[model samples]
Target: MITKITKFITPALLTLCFAISLNSCKDKPKKESTIVEEKVVYPSDIIPFMDEFKILCGDGKSYNDLVDVKHDNFFYVENDGTTDWVVYKSPNSGVTSRTSSNTRTELGQKKEWLPDTGGKLTGTLKVMHVSTSGDARVAASYAVVVGQIHGTEGHENEPLKIFYKKFPGHTKGSVYWNYEINTEGDNSKRWDYSTAVWGYDMSVIGDTPTSYPEEPKDGITLGEEFSYEINVYKGIMYLTFKSEGHETKTFTKSLIKTDFGKSKELPEQIKTLYASIGRDGSERENAYAGELQNFKQGAYNQTNGKDPEENMVWHTGSETYDGDINKQYKKGCYTEVWFKEATVGAGTPPEE
Candidate 1:
């Protein structure tokens, strides 16, 4: 009886020890997980001049303080493996400025001044993309305005519009500038005169809505780097364009005086380009003189969904996806520009 009792007791003791060991292992502490987060970069980090201007995004969002601000798709910073760039992007159709119909993800200078007490702006940038779907016959299609001088008074007309336009199925595009006349009477009759910096002017367009003109021989390709300087000193505007393997072009214009004051001064290009729209009005004699003006830079999308038949000059009939920015970007129906460097300041006299 005693031997049987000892065997049973030994077995129970072994079971009890096993249960205690399992509970002890379960109570042991676990090692905590370590997660690392990436640091976010802002547009202001790439361009320190964000404090000097305000931004209007393509989605109608406006920001007065850009020091640590960034809009997701419209304004942001991108890295090209080697360097970081401040990107300005806009869709073909979106909320626009009250004074214009086009969309823009652009910066507006905070300070305004007259032509006599002038200002200056410089930028080194590259256009990454323009709207791919549009009417080829329309001058504004597949184009974007990268920089401009906009008046704050009178008709609030644009004095200068530097453009980069590329037709579909073409690898090369034109770099040009347009000067909009401050109409003498009705602002609705104002027109822009385009001048080429590298290739064809804005007047060079396709004959049909789909047909494209010949690809420019001496034109700028997408992603190509270029620099521009707009210096308005003592009521005179001086423009300089520079790029590698391209001609360094320079121009001078008077902001105080009108070059298109007389009807006879209108070029043949204007007559032909504007004849369809009946825009035959001349500019005011004083032009933008005494009017408060400001500088603007970024992607001002000229392409739109408006029918070309309605307004042959300004309309593009591009695909908008009903103002869906994501769809527009995925389908290449947007304008994108990258600026590596830019500066804004009081204008100084050019080297004599």
Candidate 2:
């Protein structure tokens, strides 16, 4: 009986040893799990932002014509400031939703903005847009390059932001616009929303700004840019820009009179009406010879510096504008014009 008891005790001791060994292994910290979680941003989602970047550069649309689609990354917030997530291209890359990642504007911060990470490239647009305008009026100077975006990395075009469209009071190095463009897989459609838009020049009613102090007679005008709403319900696509010394143009994209199809001329009344706005060569005196006039007639540059007609876009002054009257008829500077019906372009106009 004693020997049998000993044999059983021996087996028990061995089992105990195995149990501890397994526990030791289990207690070992996992190395892989300790790694930081980075978001996986997709190229497709980021690429459309290129379109926003391009539109401001020289595309034939107003700044309002800018739209975006965003792609959100998987994020996990910890008690500490550290945020972890798999890096993936987000939806609406070009559309600014007031995310710290998209635009860093303190004017109107957006909901669900991950402040820690978003304060990067995507953040510049929002913050810069408002601040530049404000600074322009107070200081009566053009805001210098606050900085560049997406520089020399995944998106090479990031550096091109240095040339973003400039407003009247805002100069070339001073111009800025933040867009968190959320794209809907289809290139044809886009949504613009989550705006904390602000401007420096809070001018009076009916007062529009003109050119920048340093507006070069030689270069182009990146006049008032536009921002559209994501929902069709919101008309007057928010048209924001420096209104010279007056109220920073916090106007809406009023395309109510704008027809969907291209017009024979800038239309009849539109021409004389804008002239009353006090725009010089920036806006066409006759609607027939306006911004579209150059393109329709093949006047813009095609080969070398020559227009399709061999006329340089600069020589025409039909493109850019500056200063307090920036909101005036600056050519190439995009704004929403109301049309009776929708006949052309990618998206349908909002119902009147």
Cα lDDT listed for each candidate: 0.93, 0.23
Alpha-carbon TM-score of each model against the true structure? 0.90, 0.24
Candidate 1 lands at a TM-score of: 0.90
Off by over 4 Å in 1: 1-34
Per-residue lDDT of candidate 2, residues 179-280 (tens digit) = 212121331221111112232211111122233444333222332322222111112233233323323424332212222123323334223322333221
Tell how far residue 91 is off in model 2, in angstroms.
Answer: 28
Model 1: colliding residue pairs: none
| TM-score for predicted model 2 compared with the true structure | 0.24
- 65-123 in candidate 1: lDDT tens per residue? 98999999999999999999999999998999998889999999989999999999999
Candidate 2: lDDT over CA atoms? 0.23
